[model samples]
Structure formats: C-alpha cells, structure tokens
Target: MHIGVPRESDPGQRLVAATPQTVEKLVALGYDVVVETGAGADASIPDDGYVAAGATIGDTDAVWGCDVVVKVDAPTVSEVARMHADATIVARMSPDDDPALVEAMRAAGVIALNLNSVPRISRAQALDVLSTMSNVSGYRGIIEAAEAYAGMFGGQVTAAGSTPPARVFVIGAGVAGLAALGAAGSLGATVRAYDVRSDVAEQIESMGATYVRVDAAAQESADGYASELSDEQEAATQRVYAAESAAADVVVTTALIRGKAPITITAEMVAAMRPGSVIVDLAASGGGNCELTVPGEKIVTENGVTIIGYTDLPGRMPKHTSQLYGTNIVNLMKLLTPGKDGQVVLDLDDVVQRGITVTRAGELLWPPPPVQVSVAPPAPASAPAPAEPAPAVEQKARKGTGVLVAGALTALLVVAAVAFSTASFASHLTVFALAVVVGFYVVTGVTHSLHTPLMAQTNAISGIILVGSLLQIGSTDTVVTVLAVVAATFASINIFGGFSVASRMLAMFRKEA
Candidate 1:
C-alpha cells in the first residue's frame, strides 16, 4: 500500500500529516510513503531526512496517486477532486453541519476519517487531535497574557519594600484553563480560576490557585460544555465578575460553546474593570466572549482595560504544536492499519474508525460523526496492598544502632580534641558539640520512626544550624591568644558542628528494636 502527504493549504498551518519518524514507521510496516516537496519544511523535518527514512519526495500529482491521503486540515474541494476513487483520507474535518464538505466527500467516493471526532476516552487519548491542539492553545494563551500585562507576577519582599503579586483570574477550567492556571502560578501570581463544572474546582485549588465559584454556572450543556447563561444568571454573574474584575490584574477567558458563537462579556463588564487590567479571550476565532474583543486584534477600552482577541493562538508556537499534532496523526494511522505493512485496510467493525468514517462503500454515512458512547477506562483499584513491616522495622533498628555508636565515638573525639587544646573556650565547645549530637540523634530517630517529610526537614534544619555554631567556637590553643578568637570562630562551625551532625544521624541504629 502507498500513503501520501500533501502540503497543507490552510494559512499559518505549519504541521504536516507525516513526520520523518512516522515515515520510518510506515516503511517498517511495509508501506510506501510519498510526501509533496517541502511538505514538512516548517516542522524542521528536512527533505533529506524524509528520504533517509524511506519516503519519496513527489509533486502534488504524485501525492494524489496514493491509496491513502493524510493531512492536518480538512481537504479543500479542489484537493478532494484530485483523490483516487478508493483512497482513504484522514484529517481534522469538522462535521458541524458542513453539508457542502460532506457532499463533496460523498461525490469523491473517499473514505473520510474525521480525526477531530475522537471520543473522549482513555483509549482515544493517543489519537485525539482536539486535545493536542487544546494543549498548545492553553499554553500559548498564558504566554500571550503575560506578554500583554506589563506588571510582574510574583510578590517580592526585600529590605527596600514589598511589591504585591498580580492577581490572575482564569475563566475556564478545561485543558486551556488548567494550563493557564499553572503558567500564571509559576510566575508567582495569586491565581483564581472558575468553571461551569464544579468537579474541577479542587483540581484548580490543588495547583495552588483559588477556585472562584458562581452559583449561576450550574447550567452546563448536555455535552459537558458550558451553556450560555440565562439573562437573569448573566446579570448575577456580572455582579461577581465586577468584584473579581476590579481586583484582577490579568483575566484569561477560555470559555467555548461547541458550534455556536461564544457567550459575550458586555461593554459594561469591561468598563467595570480597573485600569491597566488585561483580558485575553481564547475563543476569539469563534466570536469573542468580550464585547471589546476584536478577532486578531488587541484593543484597549476607553477606561484602560486591554482585551486581546487573537485567533489561531496555537499557531504562535508552530514548531511544538506541529510536533504534537503530527504525532497524533501518526498514532491514529498506525492503529487503523497495524498489519497493512503500509497498505490500506478498511476495518468497518472497529468502533472508533466506524464512528469517524464519513464516507464508505460509495455512500455518505448518515448522522455525520461525533458519535458518543461510554468508553471510559476501568476504575483503578481503590486500596493499595498492605506493606510488610519486618524490613522497614529492621532498617530502622539498624539505623538506631549506627546512630548510637557514631554519637558515642563523636562525643569521645570532641572531648579528646578539647582536652588537648587547653583553651578557655574548650569546655564550652565540647559541651555544645555533645549537646548537638544528642539533639540530632533524638530528632532523627523520631522522624525515621514517623517517616514524615515535614518532620525530617524540620529536624535537618535544626541540626545544621545548631551544630554549625558550636563547631566554629569550640577549639583553641593556650599560646595562640589573639588568633585564638579567629580559630574558634572558623574551626567551631567546620569541625565540631559538621562531625556532630554526621555522628548523630548514624547513631540511630545503635538503639534496640
């Protein structure tokens, strides 16, 4: 079988259907791969690399000759007219009431697989083009917001003064919203997020951001998308929005309504916001959520709020986005024909393939795609296995014994070193080092028995600071009068304090189980 890849026609669409690695995989599977000249150039896959991977470079005419045609975007009518009668085509063909494209596929007699129609299931994750694109869109949305907002994100407290962190509000909790939350949080801002689905509130909070709740958002759509709020709900929502808007330094809106113009944020809402605030509308391409939002433009309201409504946010970082989208296409291609050795295999019984296939057997499939079914993964086992206590207990016992022995040896060494020094501070240094060894051993033993990270860090900090001070001041000689103070300051922190910490930790095993 032969597979073909043509250069995508969509403007700013840099992703190629097949990468050099995918071509290599196809060749290993026994299929001949052909790519249009310069098809993957934007993705950094050189022509020589594709050739090395056993793929042949060809003109558009040569690509249209293959049994299977792959692409990143929906094929145009002219491109579809060039396909062979029985060729299989796979790409992100949106089936949202596009009767014209559906009819065109029917006329061409092509087996059209809409990759965007993948079910939201564990098995479909590897082949999900929407999620792949959403991930890129989400990441890019934050970066653009950060660039537009001219203030720093994180709070800084120094001797001079402290600057309060920027307050970031994200108006969706889907993939893009979550990514925005993380990116904003990493910049040290006080981030808050909201979603129509209450289930994701905990997830937002877990990422160290506050979850803003609005009672009016309970009306979610059947497909789990947020529905447009009723007039009454919208009014109430604006009240809450006014408060948050006044406080927020940056607001990123990622709300969407599948197959419809997005819900609008009124001019009144923008006017309510503080001056110099930034609002990034992620659903700008599908009509924006903000009245001030102009598709592909950044507009500042009369009062001073910046509303950014740029379409194709993912295309801003084309290299990484292409890599991800290309990988998704490769995965689906491999799954559909694992045994074809690069040949075409039309398996109609497969659930995913059947669901997304728009045309097959010289007829257009009825009820054009987005077929849903419960395809969730099996729930993980709730409980973990009971762990064996013997090994853990024995390890603790051994550690206790070592600690006791090391502590005893350290105590003896400290006494001997101080006795020979015969300085006025020798006694004080010996006493302090011994005390540190004892304290460290006790804290470590307690923490080891408990197995708590917080406790361990607490004890570790205590030991380092205490023993360090003692080591620097403990040792001195009788003849060295003036230099004795310097020696005490340096040597006490280095020798006594350092050794005491080591000795105490090792002394844990010296105790009986």
Candidate 2:
C-alpha cells in the first residue's frame, strides 16, 4: 500500500494532513509513505524530517499518483483529475456544503473520505477533525479578541489606582465556547456564556463562569449541533444581546447552525456596545455571527468597536494544528485499513466508515439512500367473528372488586390526612425532609444537557418561594423571623440570578443590532 501526503492547495491553508511523526506510524503499519516536497513547510515539518521518518519526498505528480492520497483541503478539480480511478483520497471535504465535490470525485472515479464527517461518538473521538480544529479555533478566538482590545483582561491594583476586570461575553457553549470561556477566565476576565442548548449551563458554571439562562426551549440536533431559531426566538434573543453587549468589553460568538448561514449579530447591537470593545466572530466562515463581520477581514466600526472575523483561526497555529490533525487522520486510517491486505476497505456496516466515506468505489454515497427492507404481505381479509359476552356473575364480581379497591384507597388517604393534620412539628419536618429527598432524586434523573434551562426554570419557580418567605418574615417570633428573613434573602437571589442568566442566554440569540 502506498499513502501520499500532498501539500494543501488552498492559499489560506497552512496545516498539512500528515506530520512526520504520523508518517512514521503509517510506515510501521506496512504502508510506503510518499510526501510532496515542501508539503509540511508551512507547518514547520521539513522534507528532511519526512525522509528521516521513512517517507519518500516526491514531486506533486509522484505524490498524488500514489494508491491513497491524504490532504488537508478538498482536492481541486485538477488534483482530482490526477488521481487514479478507484484510488482513495482523504481530507476535510465538507461534501454536504458542496455537493459538487462529491460529484467531481465520482466523475474522477476516486474514493473520497471526508474528515469532517467523522461521528461525534466517544468511539470516534480520536478521529474527530472538527472537534480538534474547533478546540484550536475557540482558544485562538479569545487570543485574537484580547489582542484587538486595548484594555487588560484581569483587574490590577497599582499605587495610582485600581483597574476593574474586563467583562467577556461568550455566545455558544459548545466546544469552542467552552474553550473561549476557559481562556478568558484564565486571563482574569469576568466571563459569561449563553447557548441555545439549555443543558450546557452546568458546564459553563463548572468552568467558574456564570451560565446565562434564557426562556427559549432547548434546541439540539441528534448530532449535537444547535438548531436554527424561529423569528420570534431570534427577536427575543436580540433583546438579551443588546443588554449584555452594552456591558461587555469583549464578545466572542461561536454559534453555528449546521449547513446554513449563522444567525448574525445586528449592526444596531454593535453601535450599542461600548466603544473600544472587540468582537471575535468564530463563525465567520459560515457568513459570520456579526452583520459587520467580513470573512477573513478585520474592520472597525465608526463607533470604535473592532470586529475581527478571521475564519480559519486554527490555521494561525499551524504547528499544533497539524499535529492534532495528523493524529486524527492516523486514527481514521487505522479504522479504514483492511486486515492483512493493507488496502482501504469500505464497510457501510461500520459506523465510522459509513460516516466518513462520501464516495466509495467510484460511487457517490453521501446523503445515503434509505435502507429498504422486505415486508410480508398481509393475509386476505375475512369476516369478523361475533364478540363473546361476559358472564353476568363475572361482570358483577369485577364491579365489586373495583369498588372494594377504591374504598380501601379512600380509607388510606383519610387516615393519612388525619394523622398529618395532628402530627407534631418533628413529624411535619420528617415529612418535609422526605419530600426534599424525593425531589432530589427526581431532579438528579434529568439529563445534564437540560441543567441550564432547568436552573432557569427553577429560578423562576423560586420567586414564588420568595414571596412565601417574605410573608413569613412578618411573624412576631424572633427565631421564626430570623429564619424567614434568611429564606427570603436566598429566594430573592435565586429569582434575580435566574432572570440574569436567562437574559444573558437570550442575548446570544438576539437578531437586532
């Protein structure tokens, strides 16, 4: 088996598909590795490194003519033309977003395995190129924002005066959002995050940042991407963004709706933000989260707010990006490698294979056809049989049994109510404790993804509890008054906290400027 590593043809692409370290692994796996000259120069991997790792350094034609070709970007029409019929090509080709790529590969009789299509399941994590790049993008997004903003992220105290910490607002609580949150928090910025998926609130909170809660229902696709919001939801979200952005010194948007343009940050919102603030839109490749963002360009609004919209952030850190991406490719290659023969095998029954294989054996397999199964034919219809009547004695017995059960239940309820009404304070407390325990168990059963929304909803309900606590605060007994005051204080915090979080979450989705 021969595996070729070609230089990325895209002008903006700096990372290569395989590093020398991975090339060595491929060699050890019984494959002859061929790398295009200067293939890894952008990533700092020299041709000598490839040679030392047991790979042949070859020209473009020799490299692309190998049995299997690996690349960073989708193959160009010309590159596809160079591929031998039935030869395999692997890369991060977003086929669904560009069906022409699939068609071109099929026409060229090339097998196309797209790295972006790798599944998000735990078993495929090592092969997840999207996740690997997203982590880099998220971390880089913060660095870019920090560089653009003039103010310091962390608070400082000097003999002259004290500087308050910068406020960072992050939209989206996915991998990128979390990375941004971590980066910002580490720099001493007071970070707040919002996501359409309410379940990520706990994750945000766990990262030492507040999770903004919103009133919107949780929306997530089966693949874990956020679904697009309706017009009404967008409007509500904009209102929240207006409030939060006004107070934010730095805002990073990582929201993405798969296969569609991102929900944009409105021009009005930019105008409302404090001057000198910076906005980093990581979704710039998908047309940006900010209306003012120009993909791959940085622009400053007349009001002094800087909007940085560099689309390929991961590419900026090519060395590490190439290493991570190369590892992912190696993992994927292991899955596709056939036993003994060392040939690339396409197995539709394998989850990883089915996901990444866009074209197999010269056939375009993306948007895979629905599986068809044979069903047995129904038997010919026959006349209905007469229904059997219940015996009078049995019917009477059933009625009697129902009455007896109802009477027993009623008696048990009456006895329990009477005992509770006459119960001592200790007994009442015991019952309350039991109820709390039951509630704890029930709440624990809820999925982690719902924690954010659940927290928001609980905060709303806590308002009613606050009112009850306030009423009790008027009692004459000193101890009772003290307890009531504490309860009321806690309730007030819960109510206000929930609304604050919800408002922040809604702000991320806000469509207005």
Best by lDDT: 2
Q: State, as a TM-score between 0 and 1, how close model 2 is to the true structure.
A: 0.71
Q: Worst 10-residue stretch by lDDT in candidate 2?
A: 369-378
The lDDT values for all models are 0.76, 0.82
Model 2 bad stretches (over 4 Å): 96-100, 338-341, 369-513
**lDDT (Cα, tens digit) per residue for candidate 2, span 477-500:** 788789879977887787667668
lDDT of 2 at 330: 84
Model 1 Cα lDDT, one tens digit per residue, 1-513: 788989988757777887787787777777788999999887777889889989999999899888888888898888889988888888888766577887888898888988877766567789888778777777788788788887878898999999999999888888888888888898899998877767778788767888888776655454446667777767766676667777889888877777444554678778877888899888787788777789899988899888888877777776667667768877777787768566667676776777678887579774544444433433579867668667878999999999999999998987788778867468556556576676577556652323345546655555544454444443354344334455445644543454566577668747556
Give me the candidate number with maximum TM-score.
2
CA shift at 404, candidate 2, in angstroms?
A: 33
TM-score of each: 0.69, 0.71
In the order shown, the candidates' Cα RMSDs to the true structure are 13.3, 13.0
